[model samples]
Target: MTDVVVPATGYVIISASPDFSCPDSRRYYRDKGIMQGKTVIYGDIISAEERRAMKKGFAGKLANLVWRRDKTLFAPDESCAAVFVDLDDPRFANPEFLVSLATAGEQVRVIGKSDRNDIQDTIKVSKLGVAEVLTSEQCLTRLHDLLNEVEEIATASEHRDTRYTIDALIGSSPQIKEIRKTIRLLAEVDFPSALILGETGSGKSLVSRILHNTGLRGKHNLVEVNCSAIPDELFESELFGHVKGAFTDAKNEKTGLFEFAQEGTLFLDEVGNLSPSAQAKLLKVLEDKKLRKVGSVEEKDISVRVVAATNVDLHEAIRAGQFREDLYFRLNLLTIEIPPLRQRPEDIRDLIEYYLNQFAVLYNKGTIRFSENAIEDMTAYAWPGNIRELCNVVERAVLLTHRDEITAKDIRSALKRGRITAAERRQLTIELPPQGVSLEDVQAQVIKRVLDMFNWNKTEAARYLQISRPRLRRIIQAAGLEQNRRRP
Candidate 1:
């Protein structure tokens, strides 16, 4: 007899085995009589209430599940559940094909007729990611251990919700309001793919999480991969897992990011930085809905939502032949562009208030506030690093300011680091020969030129050189430009 149990306060039993008299399956019997005031008829009379409870208890979370059945060609969609299959059934002829194909969070265990099953068949199926190839004789001892593992992982994942929601994208500006609305709408449907465009540090990662955590598949894993960080040589192996002995160093079988994110969202950050070959491989998988491991011939069907984020302009990248045009179109289906913090200056105060409160609570600084003039000064500055820069400035002020109220002077002091104009940066540029020159020599000459240009007024020279006063002093002392300082 095959049986499955999904537990709520109690357990909901589902028995799929054809023969209840089969003595081998009797090992699963926990008791002879009723359990939790319900008759245990070996998968008979599973009450509607128990089923409802089972479904409700684990809503948006991984449920403790077990399914044992005769071998068949079917894939289960139980995210992170476990299944047992009888490999002695006629379906065992093609052992590779009989290995269970599981969704994002599921494992398959196969029970063969004997302990010494065909070595070749075992090797082939194991490489296909079968959780275990065991004999029916082994089930009595191993089932308990496998179930324990599933329960532990499920319990551990209970705390995995993204702390961000649509509200976490805090701002009252029209742009902010619209973005929130867009995220909420996106959360209601299962879109195949989406593209997030924005400047660096403009909260693309936050938006991606909000998109995943609030969406239909939020309960499943949200696997994130940084496209720019993965080496081109290992892109395929990293994203689509390889079997054991696939490569010299591939010591064990591996599961790729896509498999980990099965039936969930895969956030590919900095997607525009993918190499041309990697882009082609990604596009093929996206179109075919299947991926073959780097060294394996078998292809696994994939069901993952792809959400890609990038600061690079893909249109320019396509024109420059740096990115795939087809891949761009695939990802651009549903797009959200985050406006840079400078363009949405109205949101600056709201951000300041939010971050200030967060930092205050974190550092146990009670009831500190930014002065009106301080907020005004910050609202007027062009934040080159966007919201990320604003966060740093707020954290710095909170840590450095001594009083309860931060004044305009404190804000100014925190923001005093040099701001270089494009033209000024151009002015500091110099040509280097094929044989690279010393970096220190170049820096020394640039500092000397800026000092002489500003007539050695340290404040003006510091501003012109785009560095702090203390840093400028250090450069002066190190480069021996102290003597050239204009005398008071």
Candidate 2:
């Protein structure tokens, strides 16, 4: 006999075989009264053919199935949210077939009738991915508890996945769809190394965390290291550890990042900035999967998956002899290039809404809304700093705006006070005096104007002009306008 509950519809019982009787099972659920006022079909009144037809009829409507192993027959084509199996029955003795029935996203519970060594059998069955194991004495209460817990978890998981997962990436653009697909595919694979390349603030770090948190190594530690931030002299020691008395500061034997992330993941941020010596050491470790402490002759084997991210182009650095080609190849086994914000403007509105909601809850404030004009301006603006800049803008607007609705003026003020580039602030317009103007003269004039605007501060001027200070200096020199400095 099989008892099924079609969630939100009603409960029903179908007896599949007349020869196999389960009066105790029927009486147990009937006394519980959970299935009162539900439909019941008797196998004695219906033929075997009629039972098969009924099973096929209710296939799509069923949400969960609870079967008595001795009396119930297996319906290979039927599937449900959860399945309960009587482990004491000889017909359901094959653990492999029971596991196969569980499948992905489906729950299976094994119930034992005897107390003899059932705990050991439960442990063995759990290894095959059975969700829960219980004795028949505790079966009713445990089953009810398990169902409630599973329902709550399923609801929360759905909500969380919609908010923070790759699905929450929030874009309908082709580039974003491709990224989502790539992330899904990569999550399924067991690749050891992956490289994430993008501009600063383009969510490379977010991607790294998602990959580790959702992948097989999710349960283990995920160690992150900023290669550009570490000093060149301490790079090897910091990454590979050192023995006690290995150097002046080496008073204790230290565990390196590799050992810390053993059987897990190690994320190297800004990996393209590693020094030549550090790169060689990293390459050796990647090649051999082993490392030695600074003063120790013993080499320890590591089983760490590497995830490297860089805003700088490693290929260009390699061409300039600033990054190692071999290390690049090793880390670049699987590459995911994130498109800049400007390339996916359709996602800007969704991102703005998401951050607004996030910050509203974080700051314990009421819900905030954005004016149409504000959304228009934000969507049209070129976010050179990408999602990071947008988040800052939203945070500042939320904190500073007095009204619940943010207008374009609020966005503009936030941008101006934050980091508005000259291109975003003012459009340069040049009108020739009926006579053609020298391109160099125009360039020199613009450069002088920017320098004077920032009080002759080359660093600030370069930032406003969206160029490096060295590049700004070269432009000033080429234009022969070095003497046009404003005294502070």
Candidate 3:
């Protein structure tokens, strides 16, 4: 007999035989050896026919019944033991035993074995203890309980996937590196209610996720709610939950974001967009860690780490009286201010390379690289929309790159179609002055401006001037342009 660890003290023999159709039995077989384990519901059911078969060897002996390793059912020196269960047993109706086993594989132990006999091998069950029989109605009542539990476990797991993966945080810039280090340091503390202030597309939501996934409650819930996305009428119901019939359309009771994020993290994206009333309600929740469901008298005391993000300036909003000052202070516990992409201009190249590689493999394209001019143009314009804009640019370039290298023409074409507004365009003019700045100085400025304008193109700038690479190099050296116009 194979050894099976007991999860709970019930149902020792789970039906192993495919033929046995007992709904309660987990597996079915004869148990070998002495009663060496814990006291629980267990035994081998020896049917009357099998008992008759035990007396004399026959063509239809228990050996015929055994279906394991190729040995006769039992040795001549061994005697088989048997216990018989009724066709109907009450224990099958109770759910406490089955649910624990099915979910955690806890609260039960079961096994199976078979012995040789002469008359005929038949099915049986051994009852180890007395249990009240549950009616067929009872079993039917909770028939789907186990399946529901399994499904819920699966869905919850899916909803809460990826608490902390570094890939989710998008950059390798020095600023990003510093943020990473800060997160590592903060993971050691109990800092609560952090505010992630930044422009849109600056990856505030991503940073919130990083904090939740890497912090103390990594194994717990990390629920996200978009404040701006929730309708005004339903804001309370969405965040603090609502009782059935709380409003005209509130036909059924509903759980809210606070309940879902209890004892874990609540990422309120666009928290600054909350209306005046919502702001008040949210402030109350933050102060008291308690919320009363709409149309209900009862209140729930919650414990959650609040992480709020916003594209709007809360300080400005507060000055304009659009946001509450007290609430702003509450949310500003450990503020992380993410500058717009244009401000952290040094990071564009790395982001370009990262996103290009990501999209190239995703779109099943050959290896791709940005031409010098293409890189320059990207860096030149102020990315008002920041990394988010860069991402869109890179994605489009990867899809449209006919050649392996993404050239200036491709970028200009994409931009011409409105990747950027015409008003934002700044053309690089590399003319040497008549009595102007030294040729070297002019070359340096021209190259730097062109690099920033076209996003850093050696060839495009050279071509624009109708010059060759060697000649361009001499001019670059004479002008000391290399020190000023390199792309990191």
Candidate 4:
């Protein structure tokens, strides 16, 4: 019997024989010794003519049935072991059918095509209670392979082990080595605060997590906040919370993140984005080791450690009167600066190997090996988006390219447009003439320059300009640049 473990309490046994189909029964011929589980959902149904062809020997046999079938035969209930349904199954189109499966089991997987419509349909079905959508290729292989790997990840996350160690910082470079050493030292002491500085996607958040999970307070919660995302008016309330009736919308007394993260770590991401008032308030809490809820006079003593991270230059921010100087000094006591992926080229290959194997298993594409030229091309390039960008490239290559070996062409196709150097950025800087210029002309020139810099890639241009893709497209069309360009 071909056994597949669902996230539920039992196994899903799929077979090729049509004799297993029973209109009135939910389970087929199940061998307890082989198909040992609380329940078993037979995963295929064939026509009456095919059912009549089943000989005595073929009647109860169970095996892999990877061929595309239009029907799934099973009645899911509280005792359902698993539900294996295809996207095109007529019954699958019903919301109640999916809901019943979801209510019975913890997981529902729909096997479908890898095309856009099917992918979008999978997303739509997820709202109706589908947990995961697997493409036919993913199902063809790694049915058993996925179980162990997925279980390992789930176990690690539930036990709080993944991404919470110095080893999570995957690199052999000296810079990464020094960061790990620093983290080990930080964990030995009860430091009040620490600072992490790096470019976007350079593992600053991972470093903060490691710093918290490896320390004495590892057992406690690690509350994270994106300082830039919080509104200026709600900054104080979000951090300190508020008592009931403190504001128009404060219907009930609420505990803030600081209190929730008691004796643990409060990770403040993009701290440099905090307003002057927010910065002053945060600095006070850091200095006093206590916090008073909004609209309250009583202060609660706190022992939580603060680990703040930012991609911007706080020194320059302070000089520009944007970030507070006092707050910077307070958090800069223990500092860790992560080198960009480009600076530490030694780690690129390691990262590539790690992500390749990871995504290969994740997508069920067995043993995808990158050609030497592919590795060389990726390693020599400057990864402007750092580790995050590299991951996206590798995942895309694994998901889209259907082959055992990946070539340099595949790597280059997945990688983003080349990042512009600081010198190049300066060289392309715009200047105003003595006669002055129209705002429209200046705007058009700026858009054109950014687009050209990224080799006319609209997505990259939009990101660099801090605008939406549609808006960028409109500007390009208005400037008549779209007519001249071949690619979107």
**Candidate that would win on TM-score:** 4
The lDDT values for all models are 0.64, 0.64, 0.56, 0.64
Query: Residue 455 lDDT in model 2?
Result: 48
- Model 4 whole-model lDDT (C-alpha atoms): 0.64
Kindly list the per-residue Cα lDDT of model 3 for residues 1-488, writing each as its tens digit: 11111111111111111111222222322133111212221222333443343323122222312222221223323332221122232343123433332222212222222233211111122122211122232222122222222233234323433324555566667787788888888787767789998877788877877787667755445666667545566577767878898887566686776776666678888888889998998999899888999999998898889999987868799999999999998998898888777666678878888888877764567667898788886776566556767787787777667788988777766554444433333323345557766655665665665544454566876776678867777877776766665342
Superpose all Cα atoms of candidate 4 onto the true structure and report the RMSD in Å to 1 decimal.
14.4
For candidate 2, what is the lDDT? 0.64
Runs of candidate 2 with Cα error greater than 4 angstroms are 1-164, 420-488
* lDDT minimum window of 10 residues, candidate 2: 9-18
Itemize residue pairs with steric clashes in candidate 2.
none
Comparing 1 and 2 by TM-score, which wins?
1
lDDT of 1 by residue, 321-437 (tens): 999899999999999999887678899999999999977764557899998888987886656567877887787788678899988778666655433334323333344779888
Local accuracy of candidate 4 as per-residue lDDT tens digits, 379-420: 765566778878878877776688899887776666544343
lDDT of 1 at 271: 92
lDDT of 4 at 371: 88
Alpha-carbon deviation at 18 in model 4, angstroms: 49
